[model samples]
Target: MAPRSPPKRVSISHSFTSFFLGFLIPCINAAPLGPESDRVIKLPNQPATPSISQFSGYVTVNEEHGRALFYWFFEAQSEASKKPLLLWLNGGPGCSSIAYGAASELGPLRVGENGVDLHFNEFAWNQEANLLFVESPVGVGFSYTNTTSDLTKLDDAFVAEDVYMFLVEWLQRFPHFKTRDFFISGESYAGHYVPQLAELVYDRNNDTTRYPFINLKGFMVGNPVTDDNYDYTGIMDYAWSHSVISDEFYHNIKQVCDFKELYWSTECNALVNQVFDIYSEIDIYNIYDPKCLINTTSSATANKIKIDGFKRVTILAGGYDPCYSPYSEMYFNRPDVQTSIHADSRGEKWVSCKDSILNSYNFSVFSVLPVYEKLIKEKLKIWMYSGDMDGRVPIIGSRYCVEALGLPVKSPWRSWFHNKQVGGRIVEYEGLTLVTVRGAGHLVPLNKPSEALALIHSFLSDEPLPNHR
Candidate 1:
């Protein structure tokens, strides 16, 4: 077998946290400072906000690494005290869930095109459960490490370990949620993150003597990159069937490559690049979404922007701009915003996905399928969904992977409805469920917000999706 080349890295802040115990102690009837007390005091460009309370801060995960992970929590809009909690992660092996998951994908407020304003997202996931987004593994976004080597030493196992500790400390900070019904969710590279972290949680949950059990119920992943065989088959099929590649190009993909080797063969390198070139001029993440027309005048300016991190490729926001990366850079860079969130005092530029970390990720499991199988057997509510239009992590690959899971069907595949219209398809196999959101892309919630909300709402509530009327 030939040596495999490194996989391409694809991929995502805030808070003031110094309140003397006396600060809260002064009140006549004061509640102890809980994690919720890390509430966001204000946003740099916040608009008149809704009623939901929000929080942003760091949770130290590794003392030796001087590592800390950042998180943002949006309490459920109503009955938050009684609602379940959902942890949202974004997969980059090196990306920030805070930037991509919270800000652009499903968070309550999105950055407007002007880059200085916030707008409400009607279908924000907080409507269904209290949502918590974390920037993990010690090198992404507001998360950081004091040791120099720690910045580059990140992988799935390390990420899972750090995240596990993050949850422990987080709940300690907010003891009330220690027993709250909790679930894990994420997308893309997160296909690796959610399962591994859940495995740790599951193991600890079985030990009754642990300090806290984490009330873990189950998990969900969207457009995940799972086993190479199934993913390759699905990605090729999606591209060819969708006419994103020429018949010749599609033939090249089939004949010139052994899909199982995924990412390190000299023979398939040219063919792989050819396939990627198909969407070079478009947003490959959402093949159907409009492309960003970046207007850079000089190399110096472009280089500076790239060095500045998240805005490396400037895609201006418009309404809920389908473009995800650029607006994050604009909004997160403000000194005032950083102060409000109590972000790093050094004023370091933020990057959505850290190249330093990805390059140094020497560790990762080959596949998370075994983990999923175990979780399913354990009777966890394992759900998976994909946006059909995403060329990056195509829905075809997602569906194919689900079928390969080898579980007996509990419910025949069928259409799900919302607002009396066809929203998507659903299938159940014993303990796991598979879903596809019609007309959506890589970022499902951002593409089809209403449908995405319905999907999550049904999963969180443990109910069958509405049938086609």
Candidate 2:
């Protein structure tokens, strides 16, 4: 494979520095002193009033290669000092948590229409925890590496290591959060990221002699990419069950495709491509939801972007505006916005998802079931959730992944409620919990913010989802 090309390098203009300092100093003094340099006083188009304390800046994960990861940390909306810390990551093997997690989904501010302003997200997850969003690896979002070779070598292990290092150094910058209960959460490709990073943190926590301890309590993922065999099988089954494809199409795929193998045969790929062709017509991320019609890259283009044999659709936030990804790109790439967030975009413009990173990422791991087995034994809280309407990493696949574990049922599946209405369903296994968000697509928080908030509250508190309406 050819080495991945690096983003262009750009020098910051001298005039921007003057504007940055002039705009930054007043807000800096208003916030508390810890990691003050990274404190974001205000965003360019944020509401005139202040809400929560936010810090955004770079944390170097590798000094040798000049690689650094960018992070935006939001203190809990209230009683921040007493709340646990939650780290959110978005999966593309190459997407930015800043774009999906912070800008659109659970962050305190949602980028407004046309990417010209920001509005408060009432259901922001920080209301329950100190939310931290990172732009990971060496080439996603504002994160970058001076070593061009780093982009080509991207893989699960590489990402986990860099993220782990980021956490360690990030904690050093704000030691108060080091001992706070920490949890990792994300959706989609994050299925791979959240678990792998949890395992690394779990293993490293045991050997504090060489690493700084992270108080990792548990993790949760939504519509995660788990075992390849189960996920692929689930994809076809889901498409058929949901009536996304005809019975004949489904039958042909099952007959020609052997999902158990690491690589699909040409016949299977061809069959799958046919499915993608149909999926392109609808929002594959959320089958029932409308596609972002105005966006240049349609769902067809998104379905073609894959890592290894796994399909990775373009990261989109589902809600009032279907084109949330483009808005994020427009908002974050603004020079003033970058200056406010201390983001140096190198020469390349910020994008919600980077195709180059997805294309180059080495998909070496076939299954994370082994990691799941190990972590379950360690008594860490593990929860898997799915937005039932999501066709990409459907609840069907998540169900199969959970069943494969063969854990005894602690609690039978039952409907869970929020706001006097059915929120979703939940089932508890001996070591894990599986949840489904009703009327939601791939990005649950974006689609059903209230219910997603309720779900997280239940997860973090280790309490049952409300059985009564």
Candidate 3:
């Protein structure tokens, strides 16, 4: 491993727009330059507004399917030390990380009014780490899932291979970050992505021949669906706990909802869907649903606000439904989330959540849970968090899995307090940390940005989260 070096600072010649705005203090600049003479430096909240001059060429993962995977990168303004690199993967076998990571999370910009520029996310994750967002497989987001069967039969291993190939070439293209500490982070289905890929990295690391190891430090997942059984069970509990449903409904679902059908047979899967639909329609729990339903028309502005509010609430609830996007929609309607990479005439709406991605392959046969177990046994660090309110895969399910791991409990479960009420709860056992964001649904970052950021910081630093009690 290379020696770790702290970032350096430098003066910027550019005029400032605000007290917060200044050129990246030269520390984050990827441009070739000398380390500054100063030992101490403060990292800016946002890099000075990036000029067109700073935009690097796009990293294209050209495959045979005629669809190309595109990735754009930003380097520190100065190259004083090797910074940790983080690769962000968006869930949805078909969603683009560019939409999630660039538009929403770590990017310096957001999409506004028909793909127009908007305010920067001062808390973007990239500021603290080198970030890479990938659009994977073939038909996902911009990535073209190759053979028709590959598209329909996508599995964890196939994604691991495509991503591995992309990284090998990506390193060849930008050798600078090859040795930098690498970590994988994602949400939703990416719960399966980071671990499978990390296992591949570990395998390559152990093998002296055939493959070379990629320097990977660890990985993180927010509102992940780690196990299918646990996810479904957790959702019901979340619905019940949050009054999305009734305890009776949860008990009834647990009793009558057949897992054998959902996991084993096609007929069973259909039955499970029927159950979810029946439960979703009228608050099976017999409780009033807090979520407000809105149908906006004509004005995109109205739609954006409504959708943003929905996402914010979902994230805060830790329960996710983005609620409006059709489960079958192929492309997101928002221009900012659109992909010039795979914009086809088919005109399908991009889906935020999908059963197709999960059902595409026989998860019953080749689930990545084994891979995560292997990684855990190897003592590789892993962190998993979830939004408490997410119905698809609630934080309760995450807790269930941790309990299944049977790792020695390191910290007693306690409420994570924030905003006058319980923000969520957390427990650390062995080296693993499991967190639930109060009021946050599936997409925690979109909901509780501060808590999510703070969690990521602590995870990245390998430290215990602060006790709010």
Per lDDT, the best of the predicted structures is 2
Q: Which run of 10 residues does model 3 get worst, by summed lDDT?
A: 34-43
lDDT of 1 by residue, 1-469 (tens): 1124465332100111232122222234434435544778668667775655788888887676688888888888888888898999987667888678887879998776555677788889999998999987787888888888765546676678779878877876766677689999999988888988898889877764433467899999999978766776777788889888889888877887787764646667676676777778787887876766543223321212233233433443323355456667667766777767768734467767777766667544556789988999898889999887888788887777777788899999999997888888888898889998887778888878888888889999877788857
Better of 1 and 2 by TM-score: 2
- lDDT for each residue of candidate 2 in 1-469, tens digit (9 for 90 to 100): 1122333322211111122122212232233425778999999889976577999999987787999999999999888889999999999878899999999899989997566789899999999999999987679999999999988778788888889878877876776776789999998888998999999889877865445568999999988999888888888899999998998999899899887775677788888888878999998888887776554334422312213443323433535456787778778877889999999988776788888998877777778999999999999999998989888888988899999999999999999988898889999999999999998988989988888898888889877888997
TM-score of each: 0.87, 0.89, 0.72
**Per-model C-alpha RMSD:** 6.3, 8.8, 12.3
- The CA lDDT at 453 in model 3 is 69
- lDDT over C-alpha atoms for residue 80 of model 3: 16
lDDT of 3 at 341: 27
What candidate 3 gets wrong by more than 4 Å, as runs, is 1-67, 76-80, 113-115, 145-149, 246-249, 258-271, 278-367, 415-423
